[model samples]
Target: MGQEFQGGVGQVAEGDINNYGININLPDKPEFRGLVTAQRKELHELRAKCEELGDDPRDVWRRVHAQLGVCSISEITAEQFHEARTVISGRLEQLQEEADKRRLMGKILRSTAEKDARQEMLNFCDLSFGRTQLSHLKRNELQRVLEFVQQVEINPQPAAEIPQVQTAEPLQLREFLLMYKTNAAGLFLFGIFVGRFWS
Candidate 1:
C-alpha cells in the first residue's frame, strides 16, 4: 500500500545537499543522510567557534576520544560525530557557565577584599589546579574551583603571621646540618665542637 511507503522514512534525490547546504552521499537514505549532513554542519560550526574562542579543536577530539575509545576524530563514524557534537556542545556550555560563576565570584571578592579580587581568584585557580587559566579547567574541576572561590569569599582568611611550631621530634643529622647553616647558635656550637675535637 502507498501508506506503507509513506509510513517509513522518506528518500531524497541523489547527489543533493541537505538543508545546511552540505552534500549528501546517500540521498535514498534520508535518515542517515540528514543525520550525517547535520553532523557535518555542526562540526563545521564547532570548528569555527573554537577558532573564535581560541580553543584547540583537539580538546573536542579528546572528549570524543574518551567516549569512543578512538584516538582521533577521523576514526569516528557519522553517528559518533553527532554524539561527539552533543558532548562538545555540553562542554562549551559548561565553560560559559563557569566563566559567569567566576565573574560573580570575582565581584563578591572585590566587595570584600581591597585588592584585585578578579586577579586574586585567577591566581588562586591557577595555583590550585596547576593550570594557566580558569578556561583550561575541566567541567568538574570548574565546579570545584567555583566552590573554592565561594568558600574563601565566605570566610576570607588573612595571611597567617604566626610561624608554625616545629614538631616534637629529634632533628636528624641532615636536619641538624641544615639547622647549623641557618641558626647562628647552632653554627657557633658546631664551630666550637669542631675546634675542640677535630683540631
Candidate 2:
C-alpha cells in the first residue's frame, strides 16, 4: 500500500496523504519568531513616530540602516534594535523642535512687519533660498529674512516721489505767449493798411 525508498541506512517509508514522509510545514523556533515579531513592532513604532512628526518613514529607515550597518530592518539584530529606535526618536524630536522654532519666527515676522515688508521678505527668501514659504526656510534663512523685514520696517522708503515737471511747464507757457503776441501784431498791421486804403 506504501512505496519504499532506499536510504543510506535502510529503506524509508513513504506514507499516504494521511501521514507524510516528512512534515515540511513545521513552525519556526520560538526565539526566531519572537525576534521577528519584536522587529516588526519596533518598525511599526518608528513609522508611527515619523507620521506624528510629519517626516518620511523612508528617511527614518535609511537612518536606521546607516546606524545599524544593515541593509534592511529585518537584518537589524535584536541587540541593535534599541539603538535604531533611539536614533529615530532623537531625529523626530529634533525635527519637532525645528518646526516649533520656525513657527515662532513666523509669528514674530507677522507681528512686527507690515504687509509690504512681509512681501519683500518673501521675495528675498524666494531669490536667496529658492523657497517662498516661511515654513520651508531653514533656521538661518528665516533669521536672515526676519532681519530684512525688521530693517524694512525701521527705514521704509517713501510711498512715491513725484518728479519735477515744473521746468517743462514754464517752457510751454512762454511758447504760448510768444505765438499770441505774433498773431495779435499781424492782425493790427492788416487793419491799419485796410483803413488807409479805404480812406
Give the candidate number with the greatest lDDT.
Answer: 2
Angstrom error at residue 123, model 2: 21
For model 2, how does the per-residue alpha-carbon lDDT over 114-140 read when each residue is reduced to its tens digit? Answer: 545666666777899998877766777
Kindly list the per-residue Cα lDDT of model 1 for residues 1-199, writing each as its tens digit: 1222233334544454235444445545334322356676777687667545556777766876798777865566765766777777777775676666666555445543643356656676777788746556665666665555556544357887899888889879788877777685777888999999876
| Number of clashes recorded per candidate | 0, 0
Candidate 1 Cα outliers beyond 4 Å, as residue runs: 1-38, 47-55, 113-199
Q: lDDT (CA) for every model shown?
A: 0.64, 0.71
**All-Cα superposition RMSD per candidate:** 20.3, 12.6
Please name the candidate that would achieve the greatest TM-score relative to the true structure: 2
Error of 1 at 87 (Å): 1.5
Candidate 1 accuracy as TM-score: 0.35
